[model samples]
Target: MDPTDTAVMIENYEAFRSEISLSKEDVIRELFRQNQDRISIKKEATAVRNLIRIIDSTLRLANSKGFHAMTLRDLCADSGLSMGGLYAYIRNKDDLIHLIQNHGFIITRRTLLHYTRDVPDVRDRLYAAIKAHLYLSELMRAWFYFSYMEAKSLPPQEKRDAVAIEREIEAIFLGVIEAGIDAGVYQPRNARLVSSMIKALLQDWYLKRRKYLDQNVPVDDYAMFVRDVVESYLLQA
Candidate 1:
């Protein structure tokens, strides 16, 4: 795709990038807020800072090794926290898994809705959702990688929750496409399948990131390509 062809896409993507932060500290701060009752820490600032260390270290350790193979001791050593301190935030690996999954899901849902909702043009809204997801995944690649790789080994309920999160994200795209069709902005098509396909394309960016990186694919370029392909399929000639 030509850079000029995606000028609006680049603009929306840059807007999303500037307006939202997926920094570890910001994510952990929100995580701390949601899990304050479970976490023993009382000081927000201190908890946020340490939670950043703990979560970042967890992602690093889990991705380097597997989440199942990683131990609390490993986490403690990696995070520079005592076993007792780790326990203050999580009761066990199960708790930690839930925290990590919920943290990503919460931010993802929020980010998608923030970028897409209230946009009057259905085409722009769909493109916004696509770019927003791609941009956020690029920002939180480690968390995205860990979440996908570790979902199967999660305890049964956690596994179910993970599937639900994936479906909800797919549903967000489905909603946008369905709205576009209803609004007559796009030709009639299978919105659900299209949404799932868009998700698979998005996953290709994050899950096979090394392949793309080695191939010299920038995320913005990939995002515009996806938007172009999806629009070509959906738009009336």
Candidate 2:
């Protein structure tokens, strides 16, 4: 990735983390210690839910094209909401951008968490992680593509926040690689660089999948090819 692209990824990662942290804090404040009344808590929860739906729908659509190309009408049509209804949730396109970027990271992190549970062996864990990543891209192909392409259009602050979330996800991959090395299942290399390559492979599935499918490639077969490549390049002798 170029410097600008790298910066955006890091911002996405940070935004994701910050949103999670805020959400947790809000829940605790409202429910745990009863910092807020029941009515207020419920209202806040409802608002968050609506906002999430909008962001999720928007990200799913935006990834298929350049962010600049997506308009309010596009968002309205994709989300099945009126223009006024959309504005009630967000002030403008910039706010929508922040929401979509943050939502993408949050959804991705949740998916990874679910996929990583109860797997003890490092190699299996890494394989499972790659599988989960690929499966998610398949499932949320539109959102994945939208976040990758439209993230640059976000405001400076939001852009930085989004990059942070992206970096966090990358770090998770790097950690898996490092764990495999320590467990003697993989060879030592630059974990960051290898992680990037692995991510690229996964991203290419959504970004350039038509070519692969045009060649009559099945998802399982493609995943196996990726698994084999990682094994051949990174496995210990």
Candidate 3:
């Protein structure tokens, strides 16, 4: 594929999906591995399956009724796991919050890096980064919404961790824009500001999805629209 050709470079959600594995099982497996010491479940397969249920139910409950208001009892009922079974995965609500936050961050960080890291053409890389975010958010809309909504209630350290995650993702975009400017593919401008704007645009899709869904706008279309808005300021005349 000619990376420089915008027409050819554009990719849809299906292409992004095939290239990246962000399934619930895939993410939960990684999550279980990362938190094995903390997760009392000894068996990988059982732990991963239960983690999926716990995480999915958490996102659903958190998005619907607010994370702070959600109880472990509610989680157990919602996920169809006994209280003892839920404890095998998470000790407390705070622990559950951390699990949710970390898993979402891990997936988001990995998705952006996977799509953009090896692409040589900066513009194509930027589009890939943008599309990766929008598509991933669309897939995990509840997680994204839950993370944003519950961030304020996070403990001091976890809140800082959440902020760091946002900056790290933004830095990925900044790196691409700076590369484009250095290569003269994009105009000389405030790359940092541009990156922040890009993040806000991407966040809007998940945060305000009701509005977009109300209009029946598809994610692929939203991806192209974001690329257009971003590239308009990026590309030189």
Model 3, 1-237: lDDT tens digits are 122223233368777666455355776788888888888889999998888888889888888887878899999999999998898888888889889898898888867776677788888899888987888888888988888887888988779999999999999999999999999999999999999999899899998888998999999989889989999988857
> Stretches of candidate 1 above 4 Å error?
1-15, 22-27
Clashing pairs in 1: none
For candidate 3, the 10 contiguous residues with the lowest summed lDDT are 1-10
Any idea what lDDT model 1 has? 0.82
Position 196, candidate 3: lDDT: 98
Per-residue lDDT tens digits for candidate 2, residues 1-237, read 111121111112234344334443332222222312211224565555555557656665565555677788888888777887776656677766655655556557765655554567777667767776776677667777777766666689877877887787777789888988887778877888988988899989999979988999866667678878987889746
Please, what is the TM-score per model? 0.89, 0.73, 0.91
Flag the better candidate by lDDT, 1 or 3.
3
Ranking by lDDT: 3, 1, 2
- Candidate 1, position 107, lDDT: 76
- Give the candidates in order of TM-score, highest first: 3, 1, 2
Among the numbered candidates, top lDDT falls to: 3
TM-score of 3: 0.91
